[model samples]
Target: MTVSAPIASRADAGGGTPQALLRLDAVGRRFGDTVAVDGVSLEVPAGEFLTLLGPSGCGKTTTLRMIAGFEHPTSGRVLIGGRDVTALPPQKRDVGMVFQNYALFPHLDVWENVAFGLKSRGERGAGVEAAVTRALGLVELEPYARRKVQALSGGQQQRVALARALAPEPPVLLLDEPLSNLDAALRERTRDELRALLKRLGMTAVFVTHDQEEAFALSDRIAVMDRGRLQQVGSPEALYGAPVNAFVASFLGRANFLPATVDSVDGDRAACTVAAGVTWRARLAADSPRGAGARVRLMARPEALTLAAADEPNALRARVLDRRFAGAATFYRMETEAGPELLVQGGPHTASPGDVAGICLVESAQPVAYAAEP
Candidate 1:
């Protein structure tokens, strides 16, 4: 049976019922001659988990800072619950921010740390104590309320930081690489914990990370950014199944791109010639507007390709150059006689290096195709 629950701390009423907690309308930012962000618009619904994902220097962090009121946009507007707050300061924005480095107070104990925000606002008595206890319990750090900030583990300290942010009961939480410093095991554990906590709390959140796995795991919606512009924005599945361009094709995951010319289209199915040397029927992108004689990059993820013999339709005969084992799956780099390099993946039954194998391209597996750059 399927289970259902809200993903935010307060989902029903805050930030307009998950329709939109915040929106960036044609927001742009510039530094001297370089434009950091350009005419980007995005809506973050309440109780939703959205991630800003991209490589470093791609304006992901700058976008988060703009929402935090730390960086002002060159143009466009920043809205919180549909109210324009482009010129508001951080304090007036009512947003809690978590940094890559957990910025906890070394001088304060766990309870004190969580209560710091309330204390600063002159909140006293049961209100302060109730908020602190509730925040501590949400992060599962109630047992460590008396622990010293410097004495906790990295993961624990990070939770404490999250609890501290939550104590203020902000409508939105912004996380900037909050788990980067943890070890592999801890990272995985924290990732799961954060997901559960966000859901249980029904709290709207925006997370920033360059890690694709992290973004995919934590975000209900992901906005892929590159070089000061949003490449694509959608659910992780949408981005993976239908990327827009070559940059996005290579970034999100492995893809074998074959130069192909469209031969014909029978509704959604199109027969295209690959590498100008072979013909294969490919499934076109969903809602793809371009068609017929348009030079396109035929793309397939590593999981999509299979090794096969020469003269086989949608198949490639090549010598395996290298093999890398990735626990659950194995990756193979194959070199074709046509000089086109392809990446192929096989599960536990993958081939070894130096083997001559015929790679199979699952005929039914259709990937998004992009217009080749001239």
Candidate 2:
């Protein structure tokens, strides 16, 4: 796959006026002397499904809360539909939120639970009933409308919460790991269902999760965070194919980082020589180190590598340290002669543990080279 350059802003790329429905301008949050979030800015256009992805304490949840008017930012502004809502309360923000726990009322039936949000907003009679019915229909939970929340399955309960949030027809929806409580199989099924439902409704949504697969599966764009700061933001393919830094490259998937030095620069490509004295050409971004003799690291995904004859051109000699069957693809762990360990994924091959093989990059593979940190 050809690696494209990281996009700094969607608006900048399109060369048009910003059409952001939800905007966070240098948002920051603090508690006592500890900083929870710092100087983060982002924009989510209308009808876009954006995900805030990171490990725990990375401020993704806090950022979502700020957008929903639950936690106030110490600095910057929050705007929804071109209106500043930084000081507004949750109910006044016109944003729907589905908590991680599904926050359902056990004593209430599905219909009543779905109607609660509208009723709390002083909506009653025919309008509340109609909104409730529409929301339930969207989630396909009308059959369980009369069933108690406690009697419903985990997935059903989650749908009830989603219906309640959507009943009000807010312009933006915030989901906080709503599928984390479901089993593996159910989570996968529900994830597909959720994506379909949201796309059908054209609902502008911001979802939060630490699972990279989940983010990749659902998001139109993903904003990755680390240490309470924004790391990178882009589509799944852009982020995975051309990571801006080492953190993003390592976090998105399994990659083999080979230490190398720049041997030559040719426009957007660089020739780097590894410790084993093997030279490889890798794609380079605009900001990548261009000077010859500059230290850098080549990032290659396991599936991009192939096994070949040791005498083949642009091949590295390596010994297979281990091999494992993984259904469709087998994984081979190898140690290069110069001492760097690498992983290759391919169809079943004759190579096994304790066997010597040639590790070569596939013709279509576009390995990225990042400047090594000091």
Cα RMSDs of all predictions? 3.3, 5.9
Error of 2 at 96 (Å): 0.8
Off by over 4 Å in 2: 1-18, 285-287
**Compared to the true structure, candidate 1 yields what TM-score?**
0.91
lDDT, residue 243, model 1: 82
112-131 per-residue lDDT for model 2 (tens digits): 99999899899999999988
- Each model's TM-score? 0.91, 0.92
lDDT scores in order: 0.82, 0.88
lDDT of 1 by residue, 1-374 (tens): 11143434344444443577789999999999999998889998887889999999999999999999999999999998767899998888888899999888899999998888788878999999988998888888889999999999999999999998888878789999999999999999999999888777677889999999898889898999998899898999988877867677688877788777787878877777665356677767654335788776788888888766555655666898888889888888988765778888876455667878777767667755666657
